[model samples]
Target: MAANYDYEEAPGSYDDVNRQDLGYDPNFVPDSVKSFVVHLYRHIREKNVYEIHQMYENSFQTLSDRLFKDTPWPSVDAVSHYVDNDQVFCLLYREM
Candidate 1:
């Protein structure tokens, strides 16, 4: 027989979600994410694969550390967008 899984709803509305709800430090600074994105863009423009790989690994590690345990990894594009335009991202979440 196959096993069935049940999904649970979040405790609050999506707009209520924040760093704390996501298991991140409430005071976590986004500077690292922003720096990674800036370097990633620079590396891409300069075609520096070695440095790019290093940056990617570092960024992934940071992402893993910031997110809740067991949370699925986000796509690179998603991360990039979040880093580049977090204000817009938060506004969208609030508006939604």
Candidate 2:
């Protein structure tokens, strides 16, 4: 089941990391997951470790079950933009 996300990306530059290094995958990332990731970023930025822990321990798993049950989670390439393609964030996300 393909995700029904319509990404409206504004023009941007991906100079921070090698987009190619993320590897190419054409799968669409669901908008909900992308939004969740961005929200997670805010927690990280604010050093809200407890909230982050609660969100990951509860919300993220629930979200994955709801969103990815029908299809595997997409490749890092499809979702990394939400983290601004930061490799550390990508690695952490992959670990989760």
Best candidate, TM-score-wise?
2
| Cα lDDT computed for each candidate against the true fold | 0.45, 0.61
Model 2 residue 48 distance off true place after TM-score fit, in angstroms: 0.8
lDDT of 2: 0.61
lDDT of 1 by residue, 1-96 (tens): 211111112233241255456553433434434445555566666788777666555544545455434544333444546445555434432332
* Superposed model 2: Cα runs more than 4 Å off: 1-26
With a 3 Å backbone cut-off (N, CA, C), the pairs that clash in candidate 1 are none
Give the C-alpha miss distance for residue 56 in model 2, angstroms: 0.6
TM-score of model 2 relative to the true fold? 0.65
Give the Å error, residue 50, model 1.
Answer: 0.7
